[model samples]
Target: MRFRNLLLSAATCAAISLSASADLTGKVTFSGKAPEPKQIDMSGVKECADKHPDPVFEQTLVVGEKGELANVVVSIKAEDSPDLKGEPSKDPAVLDQKGCMYEPHVLAMCVGQPLVVKNDDEFLHNVHSLAQENPNFNFGQPNKDDGKTVDQAPKTKEYIRIKCDVHPWMSAYIAVFENPYFAVTGEDGTYAIKGLPDGDYTVQFWHEKLASTPVEAKVTIKDGKGELNHEFKAEGAMAPDTSDVKLASMTKTSEKSCCEMSKKVEKVATATPAAKPADAQVKAAN
Candidate 1:
């Protein structure tokens, strides 16, 4: 009887050890000024003219905090999260290129899952896979019908890239992972990954800018729930456009409809010698 009791105690201790392991948790907040908005060349973007109407740029709707924090991919490489999701989804993540932009700019998919790239616009696009861990790929496709869907998949690319030949402005990148334990921060700058094994792990924060070396930290979780607070403070992670990155000018411009805005500004300047007052300009810049 004593031996039997000892074995049961050992089993319980093993279970406790697994559950008692530390769980890392935290949040990532942007602590720097947003990059300046870039000036998109309206003449270049509107090549098709009548076929595609000029898009209107809505700063508030298109960008968040001048894109300082939104769409940042934060993940935990715990290899354990993959065990939680029932086999990978059969349906591929469909990314479409329409009107010189990639729909769903941010995408996350598990390893081995198929990814479909479709050119919904009236021009050709290239799926340029910029992957260091996986294989590299770059291929072009002609635009099909508006409803046509392309059966495109990249087997290897730690992270993939897709660009358009007809529209240099069109671009998209896929954050591919072997496991499904990942998330992209929303406009509010909050992220959560459920189904973690209730333990401690390193959480990685990555951003297009202000994020270098994958700001990492040990997060402690409580009661099967973990909250991580992290700050990505890299000063020049994205690196200022020292080499004329096409956007060396304005900065974080989006392609909705800024050309029309330029027209308004030009018109106002022409009509009135006194442009917006310096104080008003300062207020507007803010």
Candidate 2:
């Protein structure tokens, strides 16, 4: 009985030790004065305008109270760290549109993982993705509480920009990675990428405004968790263009009709030929 109890205690200790090695935590900070927030003119759509009684601002550069920067994608560039292997999560990554604004302005997900795009507003929203390496799509969700799960897995590491046709101001960025070792900085400018095996890695910090040049650092995780911090300046970073990204003017009555028509078309495209369910399951299981 004593020997069995000792074995059980050893197993419990091993489980605790394994859990400790799975975490990677860090913070991203800003070095320069944050750019003045850009004003978003929602006057084009009355419903969207009314939803925001307060003046809405563009999230071009979201710097926290401290020098912390939010929405930065901290990832282990797969090519640079070939030995690092991360399994994608079973649950799908979400990109929600609420109040005519995309919540979590920046998103990072593993390549081939399910991306669930949702619209939570009462008005029409068009989810148009501009991706070079992956299949590009432009579709609308006409009603409230509508969602579309897209399996348009990217063939390479890329950044896909999502825009709304009905609302010209709405835009978001999705950073697709080959591996699952990535995290987007939160409000406090902090990020955590858990479940990484102990090894040397090349960690890349990417932000929408600084896509042309990403900051890279070498980190060695000896005991499971590796801490990293990066600082970006506002001066060198390029802000996103606010001009019309091929948006055509529409009459109020025709807008709803247009959205509904596109929504139906997209539903057919994504529904019938169901994406590789078996592949996604196998990848997640690994």
Candidate 3:
């Protein structure tokens, strides 16, 4: 009993230490001009007909000349980061379905934490996480007013697509990072991470739309506080509004690509995957 108590105490401390935050913030902007969407009229169109009548190419938002960037997934391995906060985040992540749209369209919740799946919609909907990084959950929510919570296995992922089968059009992505130090850009394009221990480390920048060459960067960071600006030039990157946001950069030291998960983390991945990206139509970064 004493040993068990000691183990529990150690786990609790690790959880709290991992939950500590280090303030780091910045903006992601594009150099090229933002393309204006050309709305095409399909007055006379039919595919699925009664089920799916007028299908419009959803307008996507991308980084522009002024550079509006958000949802750049960042991750760093504990080995790559010396004296780093190696423990994962214990906070619960909320993914709510309301009015056929997923709130917090892009999320960066840590693994092993409770993922709160909410449904405020008036219709029955199911959550199907097309996941490879974590154990997949594909259950229906027959009730609308109330919702359910699910536990997610621990794993490092680029991003996983989630949707409601009943409402085919509804979609969202949960970008899970093994490291606790990850944040999603906001509307104005600003991100801040704090409470970091002093040491050398590498940080990554991942954009869903804009594809940068390096995929990730190798940097030696000292403790205290530091700043680095990462600009994703639209001209060189994938059109934000058109294609599936591809990989940008990573902090991997080996020859693997920036988007590739390190072997240390990949060993924890789920063996089988469930669904793929919905519609083959990619959603733009928020």
Candidate 4:
């Protein structure tokens, strides 16, 4: 009986040790010369221009003096780790629109997590999502402090681009993952993904302007800790095209509703006769 009891106690201890979790910390840096940020022209919107007393440059690529890269997303690829399934957090991730720009230009969240969007600017701003995998949403926030909660989370892993139809210059990216092991680098270029179980993981580093594809690295977590450091080449980095004139042609305002345009199109189609085939017309003429 004494031997059996000792065996049971040993098994319990081993199980506890195997179930322990750890943290993954890392820093992302830039190796080459960073690109110059373009100055945003907000002179058309008086309210937006008044908010920024000084010139505001685009945040396509932000690098520190020490070559620390900011706004890079660090995540554990779901395809590589089958056993690292993590529950989504109950708290919602907040994205705020202030001074005609989205705060935290890059956001990473787990699947089934809620997203709260807040508009702090006094003027009208449209929240539009250009998601191919998930359902797209486009709504207008006319008043200040207009907060909307997007309760439905993405079912698949994807990088979604969010933009403001009213303000063509305003844009942001939301990265959705299957698990919670993802972190965004801050202005200091540091990121820490906590509560990860002990195992080997394939980590991916992604920056919007640096490369079209994500950089991958292998990391092993043991004894409650793991570290990874990566550097991205800043030379030849390209910014996303956000031409106001091109985007304006694709957007429709509330003044010209979709139903109204459809009715006009129907009337025009009814008035115009269909053209006969070229062969039939030639036979008739002969």
Candidate 5:
């Protein structure tokens, strides 16, 4: 009986040790004044323009009134962190297109995790991926609530750019990491990376406008928690041009009409028979 009690106690202690982990939390702030957001012109597409009664501005740099910076990618460097085993989550990260713009200007996901691109608009929008390390994909979504699951996940770590060819001003970024210790700053500029083992790590903070320069910080995690705060200088930072100078005139064909035409063409092609070879035709005639 005494030996049995000792074994049970050992097992319990091992389980508790295995589950010991910590979280890294931080906030990113802007130091100087931010640039004025550029207003986007959606007059070329009347349907899209009508959806927004007020003017929409570019999201290149979103800073709150209190200098909270949003859309910054925060992650722990893979080299400083231990390797993660097993597969990533099967649940997909979703990116939605609404009001002629991409929601959540920045997205972060573990390598090999699934991704779903959704269209919440009633008009046509093409998803074009400008990926250097991963395969590029471009497809059109013409109906409302159209969702497409990407065939494969990114195999390498990279920052992929997504764009809508139809909408010249539509753009977003996707940050892929080998490890799962990454988070994007929200409107409040806060982020938390959970489940990190107790150790020293190097954290990285990246922004789109500040692509040329990324800030790094060293942090030591103990006792299940670590806190970090960084401030980005905003001087000489320029926002991207959001004007629709290259927008063409709107097309007359509606989404429904276009879809119906495509279905009819596909059905006709499948039902049609192939022509006989010329030699067989000549033999039959003879």
Candidate 6:
């Protein structure tokens, strides 16, 4: 009886150890020279233009002075790790529109995660998503403090494009994953994904400018710690958005009432420039 009890205790300890989670630290650095900032003509929207006394540069390819690449999404491709699936966080994923730009520029969230979109700008803005895997959504937030909670969670791993129909320059991307092991690189190009069980994982790094890059790495974690580092070539790699926004062609979808905005948005999207390729469309940097 004593021997059996000891064995049972050992098994319990082993099980507890196996269920422990770890932290994964990563950084995405840019190689070669940083790209020149592209100027955005915000004149079309006086409200947005007035906010910027000088020129407002595009964020399509933001690189730090020391080669730090911002807005790069780093996520674990846990296709084989069924047990590593994490429960969706009760806190909703936030996407804010301020100063005529999407804050964070790139957002990564877990599948089935709630999304909260807020318009912090005084000017009217619309949140329109060009989502393929998930059902599409388009809504207008006219009031400065207006915010809408997107109750439905995305059911698939996809990169959804969020745009403002009223301000064509306003764009952002949301990448959803099966698990919570994802992080968006900050301005310093550093990211950390925590709460990963000990195992092998395929980490995928994605950026709007480096859409074609096979930015993936395989790493094995043990003792609750792992590190990943990736570098993207910045020489002629920054894909700036020089496309012209023909406001004349894009009527004021925001002006329409909530009931009629959806119909007008559909008409406006059809007239916009042909969408970039699927991978390229994952995010809009500029």
Q: Name the lDDT of candidate 5.
A: 0.64
> Model 2 clash tally?
0
Model 5 spans > 4 angstroms off: 1-20, 236-286
In model 1, where is the ten-residue run with the lowest total lDDT? 277-286
- lDDT tens digits, residue span 54-142, model 4: 99988878889987878888887778776556556667777889999998798777777778889999888898887667777788888
Query: Judged by TM-score, which candidate is best?
Result: 4
Model 6 stretches astray by more than 4 angstroms: 1-20, 212-214, 235-286
**How far out, in Å, is residue 87 in model 5?**
2.8
The ten-residue window of minimal lDDT in model 2 covers 277-286
The TM-score measured for candidate 6 stands at: 0.74
Model 4 lDDT at residue 169? 87
How much is the lDDT of residue 119 in candidate 1?
64
lDDT of 3 by residue, 32-133 (tens): 565664433433322212323444332234343456565565555444653343344455678887655577677777655557788775556788876654
Q: Which portions of model 2 show Cα errors greater than 4 Å? A: 1-18, 239-286
Better of 1 and 6 by lDDT: 6
TM-scores, each model vs. reference: 0.62, 0.75, 0.65, 0.75, 0.75, 0.74
Q: Arrange candidates by lDDT, highest first: which order?
A: 4, 5, 6, 2, 3, 1
**Root-mean-square deviation per candidate:** 15.3, 16.0, 11.2, 19.2, 22.7, 13.8
lDDT of 2 by residue, 1-286 (tens): 3432332233210112334345566787776677777899988888888889999988857888897778888777677666444445556778899889997688777766678888899768988887766787777888876568876755557767778888878888778777767888987988887656656676666666643234555565544446665556455355444443321111001111111100111111121211221110000000
Clashes per model (N, Cα, C within 3 A): 26, 0, 23, 0, 0, 2
lDDT of each: 0.45, 0.62, 0.49, 0.65, 0.64, 0.63
Worst 10 residues of 6 by lDDT: 258-267
Which candidate number has the best lDDT? 4
lDDT of 5 by residue, 1-286 (tens): 3432332233210112324455677777776788777899999989889989999998878899998889988777776554433245577777899999998788787777788889999889998877766777788899886568888666767777778999888988788777777889999988877666655776766676643123455666656667766566565444343332211111111112111100011111122111211100000000
True lDDT of residue 286, candidate 6: 10
